[model samples]
Target: MIERELVIVGGGPSGMAAAIAARENGVKDILLLERDQYLGGILNQCVHTGFGLEYFKEVLTGPEYADRFIKKIRGLPDIEISLRSFAVGMTGDKVVTFLKPGRMERVKARAIIMATGCREKTREMVHIAGTRPSGIFSAGFAQKLINIEGLLPGKEVVIVGSGDIGLIMARRFVLEGAKVSGVVEIQGQSRGLVRNIVQCIEDFDIPIYFNHKISRIYGRDRVEALDAVRVDENFNEISGTKFALKCDTILMSVGLIPENELIEMAGVAIDRKTNSPVSEELNKTSVPGIFVCGNSFKVYDIVDSVTRDSLAAGKLAAEYLGRARA
Candidate 1:
């Protein structure tokens, strides 16, 4: 088993920032563990620009901004990063179970910080009536495929949500030679930023159907068609508004849920709106020495907020460590 003075779980923006902040704040022997091959979690796969406007004072893509922190991480002598390590479970008393190489080991730390990020809620959670088909996909899944894997998800598609991911995918697929017929939203107002609506969907001339949902899917082997309809008050169906959208692909951009399984295990009080650990100003979780920040805290409308929150959490975590020792 390995040991360290402090361990930060999940090597995303928050975790990376936490490590840097902790070390700079005078904490030594810091270790950042990630389950992915690369240091940046989820950010590496996001290829589109619009990140780092506030924190860096420059417009950058996800990877580019993440690279900025990655560079900083390498410069710190007190920080050690473990790639391809799964933070499987943490015991109630703060013993962390993680897998490295072929062995499962437990690592103990005086202070623990959870920077585990959020993940997309898939089609199954949407509860829409549909046959299990091959062509169906989540917007984030499609983005990962085309952006990172260099694979095309489909040539003709109908998106089922108007979240930023869906709206962004609408433009992404169109640019990749896919015909993105339309984007559907369950609410009258889009769940995404105003800029995304104007840039991703409206700029591409892709129609966004408001207050509509996929009532059913018509496909046997692959998604061949979709039945979209409008909704009224209480989300009831609006009569005589059903229309069969002819498309070979259907993308679900339903919603996002914070990946806080580890946080849940820690028994920290979580915010219902975020499904992540609740924090007032310091990004400290209900559990002391266990903090959470970034998208896992709340779905920030701006990446600037994410970075700012991380910086705050990291600094606060360092202070918490000192206080605990005192």
Candidate 2:
């Protein structure tokens, strides 16, 4: 029956940054909860060096970028970090239910930070007509499997989104010795950056198909091939435009949605647009003391931006507890 001044749900860049800011601004009895065995979220699997260009003015790997906040919090006494703890449920009664190693615990907090990040849109969401293959993976999930677990998702791959993550994985899979058949996009213009298109696709001689989509996936136990077809302005398939590619893997990087299941359970009003708890400029949710930030608030393009947004949430949460937050 312990109580906390503030409880931050997540341990990614935003949650870590918020806890650090709250501690620095004189908040006490603050707790940070993470579901994974470690602190960083998706950043733990991103080994490439492109993050932190704006915040730190230097290129850093994703893990390195997350480390910048995590290391600082290690020295703070006001913050308690709960690793392997999942913040499962939230209620309007100001109670949070979480599970640790073996036991479930409940804690009441004066204020809460919902910093859970983003979720990848899957093949079902994209409506890709394909066999249920084992090799198909979301780009981020593939990144985790490849980089974190040191496993190769497939030997040959066809990427189905010219997104930042999908394109990046094109390079990553190549560097890992997988042959990239091509990158295909349903949109006329790519959803990724120009630099990524140049570096990951063009430089590698991996062909890119615009105004195209994966219409079907064919295989038995594992993916053996896939069909890419051109779509009309109305998204209806253009006849006689189907092309098949031989590959064992299909990587999808369609879109990101904010994670807000718990935010909804808390009886907080969420924006259908951001898919996050709706808040004003002060970042306060419809519920009196609940707040949200980072990708949980909106699908931001950069982690550095998420960190800055978290600082605002931390300040506002502190202010609610009678601490004059900056």
Candidate 3:
């Protein structure tokens, strides 16, 4: 077993920020573990520019914002980065077990930071009744397919939510020469930022159906169409309001849930509704010497906020280590 002063369980914006802050606060031994081959996490696939306004005082793309911190981490010799390391287990005593390419390793640290981030809600989570089809995808997964893999998901698309990602992807599909039939939302107003609603929807003249939902999806091999219905203020389907939309793809942008299962496995109390850690203070969890930052603690809408809170988690880990030594 390898031992370290700090072990950070993610290498995205949160993990990188925490590592930098901990190093600045005099925590020398630091390990940053990333599951992906690259360190940027979801930022790697986010190519649009709306990030780093508050943190860097400049607008940057997702990759660009992540690059700034990645460069800083490379320059700091005290921080160790392990890419493609999937953390599998965490003990109450801060022992993290992760699996790499061909080997599994364990690290026991004086302080541990979980920057595991969050996952998107799927059709099942939203109780959308549909035949399991090939063209259904989460908004984030579609973003990755288009941005990173350089492949379009489909030619005709229908987004099933008015969240930020769904709004942004509506523009992306149009830019890529695909037809966005419309966006369906059960709420009266969009859940996304106003700026996104303007830039991604109204600017492109994309149709958005407010107080509507995709009640049923129709397809056998791939997505053929969707059964949409108008909902009352209580989200109940109104009689004789069902309609059908023809589309080849369906994208779900319902919501995001914090990834806190590993922390819960380590005996940390978690809020069932939000799936976030129950913390007394910011970045401080119920368990001592184990801190959580970024979306693992709470889902933030912007990356800048994630960086801000993660920096604090790093400092807290450094202070915890100092007390452990004293």
lDDT of each: 0.83, 0.89, 0.92
- Residue-level lDDT of model 2, residues 24-129, one tens digit each, is 7779889899999999888888888789999999999999998888888898898999999999898886789999999999999999998999999899988987
- Sorting all predicted structures by lDDT, with the top scorer first, yields 3, 2, 1
Best by lDDT: 3
Better of 2 and 3 by lDDT: 3
Error of 2 at 261 (Å): 0.6
Measured with C-alpha atoms, the lDDT of residue 21 in candidate 3 is: 92
Quality of model 2 by C-alpha lDDT = 0.89
Candidate 1, residue 207: the lDDT equals 86
**Per-residue alpha-carbon lDDT of candidate 1 for residues 175-272, written as tens digits (9 for 90 to 100):** 98989888888888899889999999889899889999889988899888888999996788898999988888888888888777786786877777
> How high is the lDDT of residue 152 in model 3?
97
Show pairs that collide, candidate 3.
none
Predicted structure 2, TM vs. truth:
0.96
* TM-score, model 1 to reference: 0.95
1 or 3, which is superior by lDDT? 3
For model 1, the local distance difference test gives 0.83
What is the C-alpha lDDT profile of model 3 across 17-108, one tens digit per residue? 99999998899899999999988888888899999999999999999999999999999988999999999999998889999999999999
Model 3 worst lDDT run, 10 consecutive residues: 317-326
